[model samples]
Target: MRIDKYLWCIRYYKTRSIATKACKEGKIRVNGDSVKPSRDVYPTDKITVRKNQVNYELIVLDTPKSRLGAKLVDIYRKDVTPQETLQKLDLLKYSKEYYRKRGMGRPTKKDRRDIDDWFDTPESPENKDDSEE
Candidate 1:
């Protein structure tokens, strides 16, 4: 299967466009070198991806005939070395914690006040010299 298609089928990306973009940006590597979207992928290949802040590494076990659900994900690939997997998990955990602590809710009055305070603070002044002279 093509690298991009395999990635899409495995649910690494939400859409093929995103997968192609990742390939173009060198976010995907195969056999320790960056690859294009059209590159061929086969079982036992080592694929690495840098999505968000985490680095995920997987070894292809089998090519899925179709897109799979979460329950079927294990049949398609296997997690790589323990240390790398732990690092990836840590990064994901940190990202989730950061988002949760920041509160993914609509801005409250207090939140707006905090934003305004930062903008109005003298030490972190906004550039007010917009007038072209």
Candidate 2:
């Protein structure tokens, strides 16, 4: 099976096109070397997919004729991703959740209007003196 097709079959990517795109971008590696989307994938081939800031290591166990069910996915490939990498992914998720305060993200519509009103209004007494010079 083609590398892209294999990835899609295993549900690694939502679509074959996405897998193909990833391969073209050099995000898919076979046996440690980046492979093209058309690269042939056979049993025992080692695959490394870089996605969502993680490097997923998989060993091909068999090539399925078609896409496999979520429960059956393990029959086709074996995931050997490191424990540390998965732990880091968990840490990354937690860090992102608290990266910003609840109300400190992008300004809301009303906040934007308030900012525009502030800037569009006449200069304040403190600002007026600086412009005169």
Candidate 3:
């Protein structure tokens, strides 16, 4: 099967187009060399996919007829990614928590305006409020 199609069938990518785009960007390698989306994939081929700031290594065991469920993905590929790489992914998740706490959602318009005001400038120090005068 084509590399992109094979990745999609194995659930490596949510859509075939995403797999193809990754292949075109040279983020997918087969057998230690970069491959195009149309490259043929076979049993025992080693695939290295660079995604989410990690290099995920897997060996093709078999090609599926169609996209597989998340639970059945292991049947078509054997993930050989190093433990350290997965650890790094976990670390990345932890680092992002410092920037935004959970359930905060995105900054609201008022929050943005407040931030902008804080950074823009204070009225000249000499421009005191009537109360101060």
Candidate 4:
């Protein structure tokens, strides 16, 4: 199976287009070397993917023609290392931080005022009087 197809079938990506995009962007590698979307993949081949802020490493155990159920997904691929899982957790932490800092709803008039106030803070060195010392 092609690497992109295999990745799609295994549910590594939401769609084949996404898998292909990742491959084209060099986010997908085989055996430590970047591979094209058309690259053929076989059982036991190692694949690495970087999506968003997290990385994933998976070993192909079987090539399925279609997406499998959650229980059967394990039959196709295995998580070879903990790096990606750790990175994903870290990414989630960062995402939460971002949402907390930026707020989640559509920007209201008050929100815009707050944002402008933050940017206009006189504490910024560029706006400070250096000669005051």
Question: TM-score of every model?
Answer: 0.66, 0.78, 0.76, 0.68
> Listing every candidate in turn, what is its Cα RMSD in Å to the true structure after a full C-alpha superposition?
10.5, 8.8, 8.7, 12.2
TM-score, predicted candidate 2 vs. hidden true structure? 0.78
Lowest-sum lDDT 10-residue window in model 1: 124-133
Superposition TM-score, candidate 3 onto the true structure: 0.76
**lDDT by residue for model 2 over 67-107, one digit each (tens)?**
98999999999999999999989999988879765579898
Estimate every model's Cα lDDT from 0 to 1: 0.86, 0.95, 0.93, 0.86
lDDT of 1 by residue, 1-133 (tens): 8898888999999888899999999999999999999999999999998886667889999999878897888899997755976677778888777764665777778889998998886632245554333
Q: Which residue pairs overlap in candidate 2's backbone?
A: none
lDDT of 4 by residue, 1-133 (tens): 9999888888888899999999999999999999999999988899998876667889989899787777889989998768658867887988877865656778878899998998885576754667566
Candidate that scores best on TM-score: 2
lDDT, model 4: 0.86
Clashes, model 2: 0
Identify the superior model by TM-score, candidate 1 or candidate 3. 3
Ranking by TM-score: 2, 3, 4, 1
Sort order, lDDT high to low: 2, 3, 4, 1
**Error of model 2, residue 10, in angstroms:** 0.3
Predicted structure with the largest lDDT when compared to the true one: 2
